[model samples]
Target: MSRDEIIDITNKFLVEEFEVDTEVVQAEANLKDSLDLDSLDYVDLVVIIESNFGIKLESKDFTDVNTFNDLYDLIGSKLHAIA
Candidate 1:
């Protein structure tokens, strides 16, 4: 998927699942601390990412992903690798 597609999916998921403001869900929005997503929410986020991107992400793939930029890079890399 493209970067805009990823951001769009993430924005929709965040708004629907987490009840967050769509305007706040930017490409640079942090997921862990900035978004205040707990462990359960993180799992759900992972599920959505994998399901939408058709990529299986291991837990360790997010170990060092702290920011939205980190997530963007990770997703792009994983999708590229799988492709």
Candidate 2:
């Protein structure tokens, strides 16, 4: 999948699963701050990534993922690795 598709699907999941506002899911937006995600939310996020993208993520993998764009790149890289 292309980066745009990854962003779109990730945004949809954030909106639908986390109940985040569509406008808050911007590329530069801070994932934790913008979505008010807590530690429990991270667990759900991991599940979402695995179920949707078939990518198993570790907490360390998200250490540098401050923004949605970072997440897009991480997911993209994992997809590429699998492909």
Candidate 3:
């Protein structure tokens, strides 16, 4: 999938599943703050990402993900690796 497709899918799921406002789901937004995600939320995030992109992600994969763009980049890299 293209980068745009990844962004679209990520935003759609964030808004739908996590109940995040569409306006707060921008690339520069802080993932934890925007999603109001706690530790347990990280597990949910991992599941959501795998189900959405068909790529396996460990909690460690999110260690560097401070912003939404970081998460997008991580997913992009994983998808590229799988391809």
Pairs with steric clashes in candidate 1:
none
Give all candidates' CA lDDT scores: 0.79, 0.93, 0.93
In candidate 2 the C-alpha lDDT for residue 44 amounts to: 95
**In candidate 3, which residue ranges exceed 4 Å CA deviation?**
none
Q: Count the backbone clashes (under 3 Å) in each candidate.
A: 0, 0, 0
| Candidate structures ordered by TM-score, highest first | 2, 3, 1
Superior by TM-score: candidate 1 or candidate 2:
2
Q: What's every prediction's RMSD, in angstroms?
A: 1.6, 0.6, 0.7
Q: What are the per-residue Cα lDDT tens digits for candidate 2 across 1-83? A: 99989999999999999897799999998889998999999999999998999987899999899999999999999999999
- The collision pairs in model 2 are none
Residue 57, candidate 3: C-alpha displacement in angstroms? 0.7
Q: Against the correct fold, how does model 3 do in TM-score? A: 0.96
TM-score of each: 0.83, 0.97, 0.96
Cα lDDT tens digits for candidate 1, 1-83: 88888767766776787787776666666767556788888899889888878898988999878777788788889999988
